[model samples]
Each structure stands twice: as structure tokens, then as C-alpha cells.
Target: MSPPAYSRVLLKLSGEALMGDQGYGVDPAVVTRIADEVAEIRDIGVQVAIVIGGGNIFRGMAGSARGMDRATADYMGMLATVMNGLALQDGLEHHGVPTRVLTAIEMRSVAEPFIRRRAIRHLEKGRVVVFAAGTGNPYFTTDTAAALRAMEVKADVILKATKVDGIYTADPKQDPSATRYDRITYLQVLEQGLKVMDATAISLCMDNKMPIVVLDLNERGNMRRAIMGEHVGSLVTV
Candidate 1:
């Protein structure tokens, strides 16, 4: 087979993706499926690093909306992310793929602290690095964390795995008239308020001239196809 299109990629997986068909928390079957997909990409010689969100366990914004302190809620959300990181690590390792769980909150007992150089080194050595805890700060989403980590690691692109196959003009599930965009501009996404990613994350990628590919994680082999540059989803570019 031909070499992969991208040597390195940062995969942004939302916590809800881990829930699968369940209402909340993780589904072991979903984790295993994701692990298998990740392993396939790694076996193809593509360096993979991931930043997982904690929406499945806890959402800081949701808490804040319920009158809780925003910062405190965000911290709790960060901890939830760590829990997800561990789960993903377990799944990946079970498939014989070496993985590391690094947290921004400095949990020395369970995971290593987030170190940029060390993370890159881990990827270089063929170990997938899972960045958890959402930048170790409040008021930032995991989307922003993904962008920041991708830039730090100099990843070629960010693969944002979502439930939908690609970004649509409207919510596809609710609006049958919605259409998917094969390619879109950062300015357009911002102006239209498309939910491809958060504004902060989009701005970060735009400023750095980094590209993002939004694809459906539930689709079998979609992640591999995206990594291979097969036009699997919508591409957001400058």
C-alpha cells in the first residue's frame, strides 16, 4: 500500500462518542471499536495523538448554567476528562497498541503531567499520547485543548470526530434539507456559526494556518480514510 498522506495527526474525540448508544458514561463496545480504528491508523505508520473531551461524564458549561461556579465546574469537568483518558488508554492497550495518558492537572499517581517535548517524543517512539484535563484551566473547551496540543506537537492536521459525517448547513437530523460541505473556509464557519468546533478552537487553527477535517467517528473505517486524505469529510481551511 502507498504511504499515508499525513505522517502525524491530532485526533479530537468527544466524550459523547464514547457513550455509543447509551444515555451517559462509557460503553465498552464503543471504546473497543474506537481502539480498533486507532490501531489501524497506527499500524499504517501514522503517528497519532488524541485529546478527548469529558462531556460524557460532566460538562462544565452545563453545571455553570445550573448556577454552579464556572471555574469549579470546569475543574470537575477536567477530572472527568482524566477518567475518559484512562478508559481510552485501557482500550488501546488491550489491542496491543502502546499508549500514554497525560493530564494537565499533574496527577502523578495515575498519569504523567502534560509535557510538550515528552508528548512529541512519545509519538515519535510509536506510542499514542492521550491528552486529558482540557488545558488544565477553566473557561476552555477540549476543542481548544486539541488545537493547542496539535500546534505544540506540529501535527499536520486535526481530525475532529463527530456524530455527523460532515458539517452541514443545518442540523442534518432535524433538517432534511440540510446539505454537507465538502470544503469550507474558516471565515465562513465563523460567520455562519457552524458547530464544527468552538470559536476559540477555530480561531486558534486559523491563526496558525492549520487545517481541520470533520468526520463521523461512527462510520467504519472513516478515521482511517481521513488520515489517508481520501476526502472522507469536510475540510476546514484558510
Candidate 2:
């Protein structure tokens, strides 16, 4: 399917999603599969910028709840993202797709520093850029980081790859009668308190007028469909 009107996009993937059903850390096989999907999308002509979370390995909130300091836990979470980013970079390269990993926190040994101009230049040259580390700070979620990077890269849309297909009225796992939205407005999402993404992340998108497409990453080629602006999931736009 032809994409609606996206020249470039930022994909926000949760780390736990990369773990498949194992519940913690990345499953190499799963990460490869995700990379393959991304590679396929890239082949179709979408400049992709990705922000991967570290919840699969460690979540700052979970660690802090267990008596770990919030800032330290967040830093550890950032490190986890670096590991995941490295794995993704390898996976994409193995598929013959040129990939670059950039970190908000400087990690010269592993990836390049996060520079907006450099990232755009790479994308222009047909390279996929993976953004790691959560905004180089604590007390923030990767979702916020994704929003930041999306804006910096001048992404046309935010493609949120989640476990569920789209935003639903209720938790589909818990409520059999839950209904999914085909499309939605930012105001409605905010007023309804939907949980597709965090308030801060949503606000960033709304303020920037960047549409967010929430689709299931488990479905093969769903990311491509989302980029094409097919009715794949709920589109949160102004």
C-alpha cells in the first residue's frame, strides 16, 4: 500500500516488546525479526528513526520501587537501551541495511553522540538511525525521549509500535467487549485518559501536530502499513 504522506517517521518501540514472551531482556531471535520488519520498511522508502526503551532489562520505576535510587535506576535503564541499540544495529547490518546507533548519553566506545544534523544526514543517505538512552537524564521515560528525537529529526509522524493493535476503550486483554479506535483526536485522547502513550509524550505530539499511529509490532508488515497511512490502527491527530 502506498503511504499516506510520510517522507520520514520516528518509531517508538518498547524494550519489553523486543523480548517476545520471555518477559525480560532481549531475545536475539525476536530482535532480529523486529529488525527485519524495519529493514523491509526501509526498503520501501521510509527514512526511519527509532527510539527503543529499556523496560525489558530494567525500568527505573521498578528499580526505584525496590529501594534503588530513581536517578541511578534511570541511568541503568539508559545503559540497557545502549545494549539493545547495539544488538539492533548489528541485526540491521546483518541484513545489509546500513545502520547507525546514536546515544543521548555519550558512549564513544559503542555509538555516536546524538546529533540532529548528523542523524538527518545519515537518513538522507539511506541509513537507519537508532536513538538510545532516554534523553540523557533521569525521571523521564523513553516515550518522552522518543518524542524529543522525533521532533529533532523533523519526523512527519510518530509510529508507536506496541503489543496491542491500537488504542482501545478498555484493556482488550481484560475486557472482552473492549472496542478499538480506528482514528482519534488528541483532545479526545487527552480527555478520555487513554493509555496508548504517556501524557507528556502525547502532549509533545499534540503540540507539534505530529500524528501518532499506534499499531502492533507483532503483526508482520504492520509498520509498513502504518507508514503508508493505511487504516492499520488508531491515528491520534489534531
- Choose the strongest candidate by lDDT: 1
**Per-residue lDDT of 64-110 in model 2, one digit per residue for the tens?**
99999999999999999999899899989999999999999998988
- Segments of candidate 2 deviating more than 4 angstroms: 1-4
Question: Which residue window of length 10 is worst by lDDT in model 1?
Answer: 224-233
Return the clash pairs for model 2, or none: 3-228, 4-228
Model 1 misplaced stretches (Cα beyond 4 Å):
none
* Residue lDDT tens for model 1, 124-168: 999999999989999999999999999999999999999889999
lDDT accuracy of residue 33 in candidate 1: 97
Quick one: best TM-score, which candidate? 1
> What TM-score does candidate 1 reach?
0.99
